[model samples]
Target chain A: MKGLLIKDFRLMKSQINFFIILTAVTVVLAVFSDNPSFVPGYLPFVMSVFALSTISYDEFNNSSAFLFTLPVSRTGYALEKYCLSLILGAGSWLFALAVTTVSGMIKGTAVFSETAAAALIILPFLFISVAVMLPVQLKFGGEKGRIILMIIFGAVFLIFVTALKTGEAIGNDIQAISNPLSGVNLKALFAGAFIAGAASLLISMKISCSVMNKKEF
Target chain B: MIKTENLQKRYGNFNLNCSFEVKKGCITGLVGQNGAGKTTVFKALLGLIYPDGGKAEIFGKNITDFTPEDKEKIGAALSDSGFSEYLTVKDIIPILKALYKSFDEKFFIRQGEKLGLPLNKKIKEFSTGMKAKLKILVAVSHKASLLILDEPTAGLDVVARDELLEILREYMEEDENRAILISSHISGDLESLCDDIYMIHNGKIVLHEDTDVILSDYAIIKVTEEQFKSLDKQYILRVKKEPFGYVCLTDQKAFYAENYPEAVIENGSADKVITMIIRGQEA
Candidate 1:
């Protein structure tokens, strides 16, 4: 598993740099807008793109067949990908927070309290998206999986837009984004997301193992 | 040693049903056209893909039973994939050393120096032949009981191919029980390196025999079309009719030569046998 992680990190070096640069740019813009909440919501979606690049690496380089031949188990490989994606997304979030804090200090006003709110709210959604996208990437390769990803996001966007336009009271049922940490129940949300992420990870592992195991070369 | 019993797999458009045993201390060559299940066989043996039916066993244990400990004894290089292009030979060596208990870093370094593989250069920057050599170096450097290679010399020059083969031959001196299985469409390499040959067509193995047995027992007979029509069908495995003559492949070459002294009998190798079988299928 360690070997697999090392390999993935090397493969993802370019994307890692891109991710850092992207966060820097996003932070600058969010600071200028004086809306810190925007970073967390927007960062997950952008980081998802970078996460997609990792899967693309395996497909483009034809490394799937080779990596399986090593001593690493299929289960191990799947776990590594899931863990890496989570870590990468989390790392990007932290960096954005740091940048946002620095920018907040630069400006006189105490702004971006919403940004912390957004991170807490958006983190679970990111987990769900990753958990969903992983099996698709494993089942279908990069190109087809990317198309599926776009379709899924587009559908989600349409639903979100429709809900807003209808003036739905869905927001009332959901926890308020005020006070970032104090307004919401952190324990329950964390537990739920952890369980959801774990379940989704297991599903992804099973799918990847079975699909890869049955592949003929 | 490796064995497969009625192993089968279907990849939608392609299917494979291959069964063969490779003994220790001998090089076995798998010869097949593209998409004839050579790579599939390699994958199945390494447990990369599960068979739809049947079983694959290495060293008498089922492939699925392999733990990381068992995997250390085997090394392989598939043609379509190898080490990641992002890793340099230097980085790869250390990773492999850490992964495999029996990884011989001294041998790896020696081979790298000997082969002129750039230690700091990423694989993406290397030529196809160089990449092939790098894979061979990694696979061969390990102190393994078996080496599985799929088209390892596809893009190699003549000298490079010979050098690789020579290194493989030297590996034989390290351990008398060591074995190698190499699959290639190139007939010349198999003719030189393998002690036995297996030919695959479509999804089935068309022929498997010792190299000497194939060389001596199989013969290509040239006959007029009329003669071909009159010839005994029992002795002929396949007959290819050209404009002027019929090229007939026979298993009972000695018997046919004794019976038809007037017909021209030419010696045949494993490659000719596979080609003739493919031609017969086309006809």
Candidate 2:
């Protein structure tokens, strides 16, 4: 597993310039945006997408077939991808939040607790997104998997757009719908989602293992 | 050290059902043309492909039960698909170290330099021969007890091919218990190195012979129509008709030489033996 991680990280070196550019754009957006909450999720979400691209790297030139012949097992290979995703996702999530909080403090525009809460809320979605993308990339491969990624990316975008609303009515429309169910508690709903996210992430890892084991090459 | 019992795989029209073994202290060669199922056999043994119906064992254990340590002892280099082309040799050393406890960094680096493989260049920029050399070097660096290599000498010039074969020979020499099962389209490579060879054609093991026997005992007999009519057919394995008469492949070279002193006979080679087995009709 360590070897596989090293290989993935080394592969990532080929696109370091692109990632650096992405980090710069993310920093600029977080520092300049009025609603800093949206900036935190934005960077982490984009970083998670980059994490998934490692699978495409492995699939290119049919390298996966030789990769599996190494000492690593299929289950170990699947688990390593999740580990990589978590490391990248959590690391960027913290970086984005740090910039948001520091910028907010300099301008006297933010409370740390409120900002932290909003950012924490995105962690589960980040995991769920990873949970969904890993198996799709494993099963469908890079070529067809790109289409699925776009669809899933679109869905995640909609979720973020609805959560922020941006003076538009996407979230307000949801608020209006939930008005009738006001008796439902928001805290319990969030707790339920957190558990579901963790569970689905595990199940997705298992599915990726099966996909790898059944693969011919 | 490796054995398979009727390992079977079917890909639409091609069906692979082969039984072969590579004993300790031997370099076993699997020789065949493209689409002849050599790669299928290698993949099955390596657990890269699940055999539809059959069993295989390595190091006296079933392939299904191979623990990580067991796999660590077996190094494989396939003709297709290796370390991603995006990576450089410098990047592979640390990864190999992390993966194999026995990986020798000094040896790998030394071989990389010795082979003229640039350490810092991404593999995508490597020429075909360079890539082939890298693949074999990676396999042999870990001190594996067994090696499964497919087309290891495919794209090398004669000198590079000889250098690559010497590396393989040195690897086997280090541990007398070591064994290798390799395949190549270039029969000269195998004929010069292998102790024995298996001829696989149309997804089957058509012939198995010691390299020495194939060279010394086996002979091609070219006879005119009148001569072939009276020739004994029991020793012939395969026969092809020619414009003048027939070309017969026989293992008993001495019998034909003594009985038909006037008949035309030529020494057998790996290429001629494979061509006869694959293209000639059964005698």
Using TM-score as the measure, the top candidate is 2
lDDT of 1 by residue, B65-119 (tens): 9886787788889898987787788778767876787889988888888888888
**List-wise, what DockQ does each model earn?**
0.44, 0.80
Which lDDT tens digits does candidate 2 get at residues B1-283? 9999999999999999999999999999999999999999998888888899888999989888877778889889999879999999999999999989899899999999999999999999998889999999999988899999999998888988998898999899899999999999777689989999999999999999999999999999999999999999999999999998999999999999999998999999888989988889998
Task: Give the Cα lDDT of each candidate.
Answer: 0.79, 0.89
Chain B TM, every candidate: 0.93, 0.97
Error of 2 at A200 (Å): 1.5
Model 2 chain B: ten consecutive residues of lowest lDDT:
B62-71
CAPRI band of model 1?
A: acceptable
Query: Candidate 1 residues A1-217, lDDT tens each?
Result: 7776677777666466775687678777757875665675667666665656666776667877787777777767677777777777887777777666677767854445644655666677777778778777877778998899789889999998776655445553223433465755877767777788667767766777776555544
Model 2 misplaced stretches (Cα beyond 4 Å)? A152-173, A178-190
